[model samples]
Target: MDGTPLILTSAERTRAARLLARFTDSYENSLTRRPIAPDEDRETLAKLLAEPFPEEGLGVDAFFADVVDRIVPYTTTIAHPRFLAYVQGPPNGIGPYAEAIAAVLNQNCNLWQISPAANVIERSIMDWLTGLFRLGPHSGGLLTSGGSGATKDAITAAIADRRTDFRERGLQENHAPLVLYTSDEAHRSVVKAAALLGIGLHNVRTIPTDDRFQLRVDLLMHAIAEDRAAGKEPFCVVATAGTVTTGSIDPIGPIADLCAKEDLWLHVDGAYGALFILADSARDALLPLSRADSITLDPHKLLYAPLEAGALLVKDMAKLRAAFAFSSTSSYLTAIDDAHLLDYMDHGPQLSRSFKALKVWAALRTFGVGAFRTVTERCLSLAARLGEHIADAPGLELMNPVTLTAVCLHMPGRNAEAHAELLTRLHEEGTAMLGPARVHEQACVRACVTNHRTTEADIDLLAERLIALAKR
Candidate 1:
């Protein structure tokens, strides 16, 4: 080995920095003009897959060249103004810098001894989120990989809290069949989590929803009563704050009331729409979120932080610690007594964690919370505007009521294949990228304005083009 091959020389570092500057500069400057998604080049892609690793390092220039040329050109431009296919959003301007710094430091965020500042930063972030949801003084949580993991972890706590023997006996040795309640409109992550945690698909009730796509509380109560009569134990109820398809929110207040009466843990999967609470228009609908026993919200979607930054806020910190902690007396992970400090290992599934809090913290501090609220409000307004346009457009119709940013529109006579074809055309023609969805089992297209770059012009153009193209 020639003088430590891993560490770059000063000249190499300079070259790498210049390349990164050029790459970011070019990307930001031409983001709008670029295609939302590049057409697939199978031949070029196959070469990448077939390529072997080289024994020697490709100098800094060649490595940068490959990234900017071979890799980037083929990737979907999610930052594009018209890339409105899903709940995903472009990262805030500050998020990238914070991510870079986080990478540079490479802090292990498991314990205060290893990452003192990171531990407090994560704790402070959870405090703010808990306060935002009005989760009361006893609440605490930790950053997770995403909402799915957060939901799973929340359910873990639910089981531990309800069944004292959970740590010892687990689901296999349970006395009765454990049932978890959720709505038809709830995320697949709920079912997946239950199934993974050995709750079984049969025990997870997917109650039907009303015409508004909201979970029917009456049906929920009926199901719970039936389960109880059948000698099954109902332990937790998973509610949706914002559904993936229509952005529909379940009736959290009534559900909370039911949960309180039945002593069931209420976990609100707010990954898609919970952050809309920041906007004044949606505050009334989302206010009941504070009543939940646990919540899963994604900072990546609402705050525009980079990916892999989802939050799980629980009603009581002790419950979460009890569910996940190995032991408070673990020799290696023990920390000095500090009220502000939290060993994140005791709060969630992970022991080795990234400094995910920094990217979110940086964005909040740089842009201010008001900026996020404004962006959220604007996205809601855009969705309403789009729905109105679709309603006014002849031969096109709104498939669902525009409540949040997801606007689903239908062509009156189109079948499933026809709808799929329309989506393909939308992408192929570079008109815009919209997702295929089903409103009450009828196929439609969904345009979600999660991108801050999406404008009135972008929405109008997509609507007009869609109107003109549907006849064909």
Candidate 2:
């Protein structure tokens, strides 16, 4: 291979662009007809696995051909309109172009001097998100890898806020065991964060929820008091805005009040449902989120952005800075003293970050906020329709109230294994793709209508197929 082959010439660039355009157009057009899950060909897959990396490049044309023939056929079509399995969906139209731009620029967004334009764009995006939640003037945040990362960062800040010497002494030096509180319905990321921070599973309280699946505020208070009596320090409470299983939103208002009374840091995990605030119907329910000390959001979920875009917002930017910022004495990263710009390295763990904010910014700017709001509202409507259909169906039961875009359904005589099998059958049959869930110890099927492309016809088809399958 020659050195000239490494960089694409103008003609090569144009050819590659044409190839990408063709692929995207075909992919989008075939989404509805494609199977939700691929039938794995073990023999072909083995061959692919055994293939070794070549010393010479295959070139763009051959590489694109391989992607189309080998890779695309064996992938789940999550972008399908009927793919209602999880809280994920296809990327918006502008996402790919913005991603390409970001990749070409290869901006390292850790410092202002290194990525001045990217830094400004990220700050602007964060500002818009914080403004949506009414997080106040001093509020600020940084983009993260995903909701898990954002939650972990928020918990770290909470730890620092509660224990000033956490940086030096770590969790071992604390006089008393620090306990973290979250509802049982909360996402597993909360528990994961607690464990990763060395708080230990024993010190993490999983308070029970009420019949509606909302966190029981009374039980939470009791748990906190009990922990305090045992000489354990209760420092932070993690609440859920939109849970994963049934889309149950914990009572943020009551949780915030309790956190204030107990002098505990309140962090709302809104990764699945926070962006629904853009919908007018969800605003009232999520309004109390502003009272939280910190919040975690995923733009990839509701915003229709591409994968791996998550964020953490703090009411007071100083708390986040205190948690992650290091005063490096190194001459290389000499801090730039500019109030208008920020050093992203001070906000999170990664010293080398990508321009993940560009895709999000581009989508928002391209389609405008109103377009997203309409799609979000439509998703909620579709979920509600599914819940209604489930309730009226002969053998199906509505597991939880359709609070957002997730609807859980139960077949009367189905066990957990049976529900799993039914989900497999649905995927195989290509009627639709749904997930399995346990609702109050009973097996159920979960359909999350987060896909913007989903329509009423698709919902009807899913309902009809599910009813027919249940009768079998």
Task: List lDDT for all candidates, in order.
Answer: 0.90, 0.92
| TM, every model | 0.98, 0.98
In candidate 2, list every pair of residues with a backbone clash.
none
Predict model 2's lDDT versus the native.
Answer: 0.92
236 in model 1: Cα distance from truth in Å? 0.6
Query: What TM-score should be assigned to candidate 2?
Result: 0.98
Model 1 lDDT per residue over 100-137, tens place: 99999999998888899888888888988888889999
Q: Where does candidate 2 stray beyond 4 Å?
A: 1-5
Off by over 4 Å in 1: 1-3, 328-330
